[model samples]
Target: MKNPKLITKPFAQNGQKNAIPENYSSSMESNQATWDQGFGPITMIPVAAGGLPPKGQDFNGIFNQISESVVYLSMGGRFKFSADYAAAINGYPKGAILQSDDEKKEYQSIIDNNKVNFNTATQAQINAAWKLFSTDDMLQQLAGKQPAGNYLKLGDYGIGGEFPPEVIDANNVKLGGIYAPAGAAGINFYDPYAPMFVMNRNGMYIRQFQITATGKIAARDIKGEWKVYSDDEELKTRFLGINSTAVSAKQLSTKSTIAGQEFYGKGETITITPQGIGAQPVGNYLKLGDYGIGSAFPPIVADADTLGVCGFFAAAGAGSKNYFDSYTPVLVMNRDNNYRCSLQINVNGRVATRHRSGAWITYPTLDEFNAKKSLGEGQRWQDVKGSRSSGVSYTNTTGRTIALSVSTAGAIASSSIQIFVDNVLCSRNEVGGGEGTNFTRHCIGYAVIPTGSTYKVEASSIGLWAELR
Candidate 1:
């Protein structure tokens, strides 16, 4: 048989029995032992107190001393372990032992009640163990199920609980133009789509902003330049006015010499009359009347061959100055000889005459006789003659009714004068003789005959008389 030994003792201190007996022999082996039987070799585990020491101490005491040291080590170096040793035992790392029977039973109850598998235990199974052995709060910490103070909710990541700050700034701010807030300093940012910043105060809300590109800046300036007009020489010299400078002149003729007459060209002339000169020419100084010659002039006479002729007088009355007659030497003649001569008379005014010679005689008609009777009472019985050789004669048959007188001087005769009453010959006589006798008789009568009547005179030896009605 093997010798039995007492590995541990039982003693009393602080009113609790020691786990080992006082008189226990080292060689005793009994069914009731203070220490575990068939336990593994005694090993020294050096432990430090409170905080970990620089070097740990080993225990080589009696079994009880060793057991107490083990208890102290398992108690985490505390003088008094908690009455809730099950909770204490749970605090140990996995696979550590329970110190008391109650702690073992409590730990066994936790293990039995919990469905824990060391290889397959999850945080949920460990939480079940903690609930059986420890507090609800301690179980929560053990299972890593604690609340996080700064945990982000769904989709909450960056500042503003949204996208990045820099990205938001870039999207919202105007890129290029100067930013001049109501009363702040102007910010220098240049972009094409921004407005020019006009600095204003006093809360005048000009809320507009503008931007322009470099190319657009030049274009706008050029557009403004197009609207600009300048009187300056530098600008005017570049842009000149278009107008015409050439002019044309035309010639015209006028009837006026007055100063304000519109003159189109040089050297225009006008004519003037005597009235224009305000005077007339006098004293044979070429009147328009002096140019009257030929049929337009009055008659005149000159003396010829000693014939007693008066200067040409207007034909014996207040008649035209163009009339005249001539008289010559008187002569007596026998009743039956030839006589022939030429007689001359001048016509005046618009009057004229012609003569008949060979064998023609003239007699007065009743109207002539009556017209002659209406003339002043005169001596009757005048005998006129025609040229006898020319075979004609004339006489007055107005008996005792005094006949008109005749101028026998310068009359043609031998040249018998015969007077006829009605158709009958009443008297005959002769005047001038020998061959060159020409005679003309003047029969005087009233200038007018009765209204319904007419007068005529016929001369046998010479001149014609135009009767007036």
Candidate 2:
């Protein structure tokens, strides 16, 4: 047995070899040389049982070694690869690490081994840990502080609500802010610069109101209690001034007088006189005792105002002689044309006079003969008989021309009548009539009278009458 300790078995393939074996060292060295020629040099480094690779080694190996050390330290001591643990190692005052399902075994091992203290932790510690592990940008966010100019501070209160304010002078009196009292309503903060208080008990605060200056309700400089109501309502008695009442047309009286003249009365009468006598009646005939001195009346004397027969005679006979004297000579006649005139009558109602001669004179009617006979006796006589007679008579002739109308009362052999004017046949009518029959005729003639001519008419029938034109 030559140096069995020096001759080692083949290195296991599980990477547990710390150093090359003596038997294979030569061959391994030659292979390494060939590999170096073909690829690169392979440096052989010694490792303790639990030590990592040294610095300046291959990065892959160095990383693996550092990872092992980290895992081992996390398992074997209070220090770990956790964020809080790393933060603590890097001089952060507080740090923490979060647990994961994959790293639970290692984390639990570290806890069980009393390598890490997880029980003595808080949100602050976790936050510190996040700050330590995160980048500078993330760390800044983890600080939980806002940048400048990012927020506002609570200011003062305003009229409707809260608002900002400022202190201007030393007294520290707030300026440019308004605070309204509870339930106090108005045009609040009426002037912000000059604050005022308006306490309206009825909650009515008009900024401005107008009052007529000429109103009877006097406004004084003194202030006192007042009651305000809607203008549409009747004013209360207490608010009404002296001598005030509701006005209406019915309240006034029409019987009132003005300027000493009576305005209203029943049945007024007025009397006027130039002489100023109240008892003097109009249309009175003034006598000597009726008027006073210096009173005047009309100068003319009317016939109705004459006093005596002389006054009547003066009014009637002022312009001519007496009427009786002018008629005295007519009572006496000197000459008479007929003293004992002989009268003769004709068949046609005419009278004639003869003067002892065999000459015959004819008067148109008896009224002419009677007038001549009265003149012979020197007597004034008036022929007054005014009618016609069947017998001839020496009297006044009353005459009328009667128009004849022929109409038959019954049937006859001949129903005819003939009309004549001045004894000459003028018209004829042969009527054939029974009931309701009628005819008409017209004629003109003359009659004699004492002083004036009279007209005469003759008719054959009694129903005939005459119309004078």
TM-score of model 2 relative to the true fold? 0.14
Question: What's the true lDDT of residue 80 in model 1?
Answer: 22
RMSD (CA, Å), candidate 1 to true, equals: 84.8
| Cα distance off (Å), candidate 1, residue 136 | 22
Per-residue lDDT of candidate 2, residues 235-336 (tens digit): 322232323433222212345332222344443432222232234477856355232212343122222122111111121223323222211111111124
Model 1's lDDT to the true fold? 0.31
Q: Which stretches of candidate 2 lie over 4 Å from their true place?
A: 1-63, 67-116, 119-469
Compose the digit string of candidate 1's lDDT tens values, residues 229-320.
23454432232231222222333453332222234444444322222221345554533432222234323322222222222211224422
lDDT of each: 0.31, 0.31
